[model samples]
Target: MSFIRIGFPSLQQFCVNALVAVSLLVGGVAHAEGGPATAQDGERVIKLAAAADKDPLAVMSSAEGRWFQKWADDVSDYQFGPDKGVFWFHNGVAKGDLMRVLRFHHTVTTAAFQWQKKIKDPRLNPADDDAKTLAGVEGLLRAYEVLVAKNPENRVAKIDDLIAIRNKGGLADFVKAMPPMPSR
Candidate 1:
């Protein structure tokens, strides 16, 4: 019997590391209730989040916005094929960023459950070694839920927090940290 050794790092580990880095960068008490400025920043935050949420291929195809589009394409490249495992890992990081945006949206503006539901997509459900990674995403969701429930004004803060995090460190480090695939 031939054993297939998958030397790659599990998605959960990648999520943990990515989340830890995010937490370190955006230090603050996970407040249940956000401050009042959440509403004012809601629109700006949403636009940024929406931009980030664009389809990777569409972003890559944009001729006029090549620089920004390339960034999205690079992210998509990590999520498919032999790189799938790495995709799951960075999914955790993306989830963390998305959670921050969602919290900002819910807290500062009207309560909208759409973003929350999207994050809970069954596709993200963890399995086997993926359980821990899924849990990390869940943790981010829980934080957003609490923020929304408490402040309903954290929308802007969350957006600002996410932007800062992304600028400080793009997703590249997380992508590089993933375990490499075995040579055929």
Candidate 2:
């Protein structure tokens, strides 16, 4: 599956921008007049987003959440269809599961971080590793989504297993081993 990606200097920058935009959009700070929004506004939003342990969209207004969902769909191949409810994470995995996964852990974050650090190097292809990692991340999300729907009773344990697989850098392997998720 093709993964949607945000064009930013780094995943960190993307998160900062997302938080800032969410804050402005939700707070009614970003108006046609340009308003009084300042760098500090973005900073406050960044702090809030950083500290959040659940999906970043959780705290946003419905409008803001819809905006974010569209943005994620446009940028990354991950689609949060309108019919599906919010709240992406399951029992055991919290803090940086989807986009956040690209930031923390021994997940693709490590590779993406390294790539971002060396972004200036001409030899490095920005899309190479990050794209694959993103696809893996999307796979992980899809797996969780299906497991929770199909086997609600074992969601906690399934999430634990997925987290373990992710931590061990086996996202693709784990996804490949799973039964196919039903098409939306």
lDDT by candidate, in order shown: 0.32, 0.37
* Candidate 2 lDDT tens digits, 28-53: 44222223323433333333333222
Tens-digit lDDT track of model 1 for 49-153: 333232211211233123222322232211112232324334443344333343232221211121222222223442322322233323334444444343454
lDDT (Cα) of model 1: 0.32
Span of 10 residues, lowest total lDDT, candidate 1: 105-114
Clashes of each: 8, 6
Top candidate on lDDT is 2
Cα deviation at 22, candidate 1, in Å, is 26
Name the runs in model 2 displaced over 4 angstroms. 1-57, 60-62, 70-155, 181-184
State TM-scores per candidate: 0.19, 0.31
